[model samples]
Target: MNRKCDKKCLELSFPAVEAEASKGIATLSARLTQNGLPEHKTDDVKIALAEAINNVVEHAYSGIASANVQVNCRLCKERLEIVISDSGAPLPGLRIPDGKPAQLGSSIQNLPEGGFGWFLIHQLTSEIRYERYDGNNHLCLRFDL
Candidate 1:
């Protein structure tokens, strides 16, 4: 069960690129850890946030040289909510997979080459939501703390 208390929110804006994404994840992970979040839970948040930011950098702003990605994190006593937004091309028809873990095959040859990011995001987070508003793509992820 989750309960909400007074919220402490942090907002970060950075370049929508692979390097910035890594830095954002590191900053977020550190903040969460400093606030007394468990190590495993913090790691889960970091991984999910990395995937979200990377999706924006790779797919949303592929041709663009530079753009901005905004991350807003709201922390409460029992839950943490993160919203990542970017002013890039919105997904035509973004369809997240059903919340199921990706199946691993028996051999290395059967390994997936790509398309595992969303699966991991969904698996790690308690809730995942996406929207496009006012020319910006917003992806929201929630975790029960």
Candidate 2:
């Protein structure tokens, strides 16, 4: 189960990392559209957010079933702040690129295997940050509407 905040910002906290990756994306997408973001931009933001959370599930948790994922979303005047956290070992030396998908690597995995979420997120979002604290890995994505 997920908890929703009552403020302008909707915060959803989930226990399973994989479930959080999917449900969080849907909830945030709805909130973005409800908050007056255009349809095309909202779709893009949803895609990027899905990728970020998927990374936490696949890479951070390494398919472990006992991990927990926390998704906190805040809607401000200028942008939306999405925070995805997991109780797992921190990822070391993982860096997000700073450009479009074209500038990223041209590997078949991104196209045929569908592992391009992180790369697309790097290209689509305005800002992204990775943090590790007390054995928790957090990925924060900022999207401009």
Candidate 3:
């Protein structure tokens, strides 16, 4: 990843594998604070951003050779816009998931394993959008700053 740092924008690209994704997210969260994203909003942004990227790594790239995850964050006085792109399978039906909270089962062992990510993402971000063009999936998450 070629790293760039400033108060308004941070751009990075890395292989979209599990370990790399985690490291990428951590790097993003840490640098965001230095790039003028309000401290209070960094956690929310990090959580939502991680969920989105995890989905890409776990679902989009499943059964396929991993590719690059492109991240671009632009900070404005009113909002922060993060654009994450990958050349993986398009979202099911090419739209954002409904993201309803996952249903819980009674037993501890029955607890769902993987349904809460989108719900948490929706709760954290002000707006979310997705698109696929020219074989790349673009997910834009907006957080009011």
Candidate 4:
């Protein structure tokens, strides 16, 4: 973490997926506030962070009790970047498709309720990136100030 950048990082473990996601979002919002981010961008940052965290919790764990989701947040000048990583399962190597209504309840949709997460993420964030490496799934989102 860069001191000049006001970068802050947090690591939390939660048994409930929703709880984990919500907690991660709350933490991000608080960090932004403490770092003097404008009020207008707070909601956008919160939503994007929640989506990234929920995707890992719901899709990777799939109702399992034992799962770990790691959230990393870095604030640089006019940008905030959040990187969420999980080790539960390998993700498909395809970008999230565009221009289609997200279907929530299918084998393709693990939680049956997280389809809207990605949609909201796209609407709120400036950039979204995904990567899978050595059995770890990583999703990174950035919000420009």
- Write one digit per residue (lDDT tens) for candidate 4, span 35-61: 777788888887777666766666677
Off by over 4 Å in 1: 1-5, 94-106
Model 4 error, position 55 (Å): 1.8
Q: Give the CA lDDT, 0 to 100, for residue 72 in model 1.
A: 84
**What value of lDDT does candidate 1 attain over all alpha carbons?**
0.81
Off by over 4 Å in 4: 1-16, 63-65, 102-114
Query: What lDDT score goes with residue 59 in model 4?
Result: 68
Model 1 weakest lDDT span, ten residues long:
1-10
Q: Give the Cα error of residue 77 in candidate 2, in Å.
A: 2.0
Q: Which candidate is the best by lDDT?
A: 3
Best by TM-score: 3
lDDT by residue (tens digit), candidate 2, 93-135: 7455443344334775555455466668877778888887787
Look at candidate 4 and tell me the lDDT of residue 33: 83
Candidate 1, residue 25: how far the Cα is off, in Å: 0.8
Worst 10 residues of 2 by lDDT: 1-10
- Clashing pairs for predicted structure model 3, backbone only: none
Against the correct fold, how does model 2 do in TM-score? 0.74
Which tens-of-lDDT digit does each residue in 1-145 have in candidate 1? 1235576677899998788888988998888778667666887998888888888889889886668999988888778888898989877676555645457778999876767888899888999888888888888899988
Taking all chains together, each candidate's TM-score versus the true structure is 0.85, 0.74, 0.93, 0.74
